[model samples]
Target: MFDVCIIGGGIAGLMLAHCLPSSLSIAVLTKEDSFSSNTALAQGGIAASIGPGDHPTSHATDTLFASAGHADAERVKLLTTEGLAIIESLLSRGLPFDANQAGLPLLGREAAHSTKRILHAGGDQTGKMFLQYFLAVTDDHVKRLPYNSVLELVLRDGQCVGVCVEDGQGNRSIIQDHHIVLATGGIGQLYSQTSNSSVATGDGLSLAFHAGAVLEDLEFVQFHPTVLTLNGKSHGLISEAVRGEGAWLVNADGQRIMTGVHPLMELAPRDIVARAIEWHWQQKGPVFLDARKIQQFKSKFPSIFTNCHNLHINPGQDLIPVRPGAHFHMGGVQTDEWGATTVPRLYAIGEVASTGVHGANRLASNSLLEGLVFAKRLASKLLSIGFNFKEKEIHLAEVTKEFALPANLQVRMTKLVGILREVDKLQKFNTDFPLRWFDLQHYSSLHIKDIHRYTACSLIAKAALLRDESRGAHYRRDTPETSEQWTGKTVELSLAGYTFGERLLKYKESMS
Candidate 1:
């Protein structure tokens, strides 16, 4: 039993733990070590309006623009405004953010940002630095459980009370808690090529859904415009900050790919740039990121430099192979300003929660900021509410099959549900695979994780099929234009089904 059970060990879970009072017992459960998360893999730094000539409003405006006007105005304002304080607070705590020679924090711009407002540490190692910092400062009293996967949320009386967790050796147990927070990160591993870690298999989404929590915007999967590709496989992410430093996207024939694609060209919103590169790659063959012109490339992005070096490709001399791949999720378990989900005593933050700040597309580098701001908010709310013990009747489902992930799941998802979408493909995907939030009694913990991935992929496909118009990261080739009808509204999915405005539809498989 615990006072607070946070399901994830990333920055958001750790940040929440840090903010909570030591008087309360807190346990953070993770499938892997703390560093194995999308947060740790983040190459671009956190975004804040702290640079010269930048303001929170400007930051919010850029974020809204990147979101294609689908973002919540109030939440975005809060995210950007509070972001500055958090960065400053980290600095005051002696976080050695990369700085200019004069000791001012070095700020760099990314695609869609109006100004240079990104702060990094150790060049491209900003996320790593943050992970270390949060892990170090987190109170020792807070328990950290690695290699523990949450199989299901235990709900009673319409409120979440605990969770069914599985350990590394396949041991299972129930954790009774006053509060349960799902900070389990994104669903990128559902795709064949992604920048997310192996643990990002949509565990939080499925758990929340089964527990009757609402999920929003599952279709808005952001594909980073530049992930290093070699021999048709993703090597690693090439941060957009490279373009912010004057890198260019070129074709196999050495022609500039983004010259007339958008006014911002290589520095345009990720959705625009990714589509452009994909189109060019299809029409003119492979595409590459030309960073030869950037001075001190190795010093500015050591991680990327080392990756390229390992591949024997010199960014300063060669055209680095590049392609778009799954990068960030713009949606997940829906939450309010306080990170409280629709379910009582259950919360979500970080990439797992759809706070509606990211909207249809996430602004580059705002991800880290979202994790920090919302985790703090949720923590404060939890501290104020304090703890109350509750015991619910325990129920265990009968075990059946031990299924593994399908061999072709990733390929099918990448082809049908990825980058570009249309009605025909989406319908085909649904017809072939379908949505099945399998009966717990029919599946064991050993195979529940695999089932979750399939269900998550189906849910994403369903959401993509429902939203007919192209907007932000969700681009439908058939209905290529954005629709005013869908703007500012969300696609809310639950156990009963989902709604996009007045149309409420139920998944046929879910009913069974």
Candidate 2:
């Protein structure tokens, strides 16, 4: 037994371990190599308000505006307010943010921000740097387990006691703890094309959902406007900061794609920009980002430059082919200010939890900050409760239920659930997916990763179908306009089906 078991050894897990008292026994579990979490792969930067001409109030405003009325006002305030202190903490731990000649942190603007406040270290290595810093701090004390993916959450009555995990060698084990924190990243890999790494298969979301945690806003999948598209699929991401540096999205005919779409044009919120690019990509064949105007283009974004160079395309001369690809999840298991879910002893942080700070759309570069801020909040909350390594008596027996997803559903999901969604497709896919999931469940050849991917995809599809209005990252052609009724409300998903507003209230009462 342990005091805490943290799934996903990313920045959130590492930082949470760092904040917890060293006397407590914490186990950090990873699905792959310890560094495979999206934290290390993040290329943009962490968003905060320490730069000149910026404040958390304005930061909060931009975030809420981008969320399109789904972000929790209180949580948004907390996330923005706590950002500066956490950045300072990370700085004290040796995260070297790139600074200007005046010795102030150099801040770069992204899509929805009101000002240039996204901070990077070593140019595009902000996430990588922070990951290394936290890993170094937590490596000695925390038991880091890689290649062990959590298959199920161990819940008895209402509290989560532990997790059932299977390693790459097919060895299965049960890990018992008083608390479990899920920091597993986004569900980007559910799509054939995405900016996220392979490990981002929504394992945490599935784990939480199967264990009876409420999932909110699962439809709000953020497709970034500018990802390098190679051979009809997504490649490396071209950070929104590239456009903030004055890059323009152009088509094959050299026509700017987003000229009249929004006031901010290329620097508009990712949802607007991604839709415009996708619309143009379909109408005019392909889209590209022309970065010739940005002075010191290679130096300002060396990572993007290197990726382009590797593909034999120079931003100064050639138009890099770009397309919208799944980049971030603005929804997951619902959590509160302390990152505690509706379920007891099971907390979620990072992209895996819907703290409702992102609403329908996530503001650019806010993801890294969300993980850092929420993990700190959770750590503080857990510390206040005190820690003890006593095993709780769990009398529950394993029960197998029907898995409701199709065998080849991942391909179907990628086809139907892209930037533009339709109710017919969503409904049809939702109906057929579960039957397939059941079939695949009995196959001994099927891996645990595949099962989790199907489950997560099913939840996303259900949530997308449940919401009939277009807002933020969730755009449906049938429901092209946002409605006032859905504002400040969320889609609550479970095995009993989807619920909303009063229906959600009744559903919980029934569960009780």
Candidate 3:
């Protein structure tokens, strides 16, 4: 038995494993290879208060302003305040960062920030460089098990004990551990087009909900505005840093549409930009980003330049075909300041946990900062309160023998809750294709927990339907304007009453 079993070997899990004391046995379970994570695919840099003119307060204010009054003030403050230290720690561990000739940290700008506070390494390849450094330092105390998918979360007497994971060859076994951490990232792959990796199938969110953990902000899915439309699907992300580097958004008609759309124009927040692009796409056939002005900076951003070259669309000459795609989740498993969920011995970090830092929308590079800060905080908290394990005889829950989704149901879900949403369409979806009682019954069983994937998707649809007003990434075509009171979070729980012990209370709670 180990002290901690971290599901999803992303930056958060790897960083937590590296930060914790060596005496504590930690096992990191990755569904595939270690590099298969949204963290590894992050093209932009991690935001930190590292610039000469930058400070935690300024960073915090910018984040809150970007979040548009939905952010938890205290949590946002804490994340920004602790971000500098985390950056320093990563630097000390040999994570290479870009620097000027004078040896000062080179800061890159991104949307929704008043200052140039993004600290990057190797241009747009910061994520790869950081992952490499993390892998290089991992010791024997940190056991990384790749090709392992967690089938079910093992709970005993309403407390999380371990997980039942499936191996590469489909062999299933229980990993009995005292503590469990879910850093399984976002639920983007559920859509037809998204920036998330294939493994990001809302596995962690669905697993946690089934195991009786509260999920928050299921409605606030952030869609990046500028993903390159490749082969009828948006795949490659045109980094927000491009806009920071003086790129412009232009429609197929060769008009810079953003000038009259929003006050901030290209520098506007992501939600505005995404909606603008969507509106443009609806009006015109296609949308594109004009990067011709910044051709001279191609050498500085070689990764982006090279990626565009691979697509046979040079940023200097061609108009980069772009569209909005699901990028981040502001809502996730509800957690306290210490990253502790409703469950007693369980915790969540990174994209999976709704730590209230991201609020209605996440600032461009705050994701990486949130991961680093919270990982350290969770490690410290876990180390302070040491845990002990007791091996006791327990019976496994009966596993269901079969599971499948009707093809029609999949099509309906994708249509109603895809990119755009409307009340009439949602009502039609629920009325026409209601989730069968048998599906819900099978989903509750240990062997059939994967069936809960549909349940999770249904929850998002239902929650999106309930939320009438357009705010942040959750836009409603029917309700075009933003509502004043409906400007906060939409929370969903597996069981009710604010505590994990209150298992029967799983319901929806919205706070403004």
Give the top-scoring candidate (TM-score): 1
Candidate 1: tens digits of C-alpha lDDT, residues 35-80: 8998888767889998877888888888877777788877887898
lDDT of 2: 0.80
The 10-residue segment with the lowest total lDDT in model 3: 499-508
lDDT of 2 by residue, 1-512 (tens): 87889998887888899888878888989989977878888866889988867778888888888888778777787788898788876666567888879767888877668898889987777788887777766745689888887877877677788887777897666789889999998988898668888889998877777777788889999887788998876777997778877888888788888888999889776678888988886677888998888889888788788899999898999998998888899989888789998788899999998887888888888988999899999998988876554565654344444433455565687667778889998988888765122322222323545667878988899888888999888999999999988876788886556677321211111110
Global lDDT of each candidate: 0.85, 0.80, 0.76
Work out the TM-score per prediction.
0.92, 0.89, 0.88
TM-score of 1: 0.92
lDDT of 3 by residue, 153-216 (tens): 7777888888877788876677888789999998777665578887777778777876778777
Better of 1 and 2 by TM-score: 1
Best by lDDT: 1
Worst 10-residue lDDT window, candidate 1: 503-512
**All candidates in order of TM-score, best leading:** 1, 2, 3
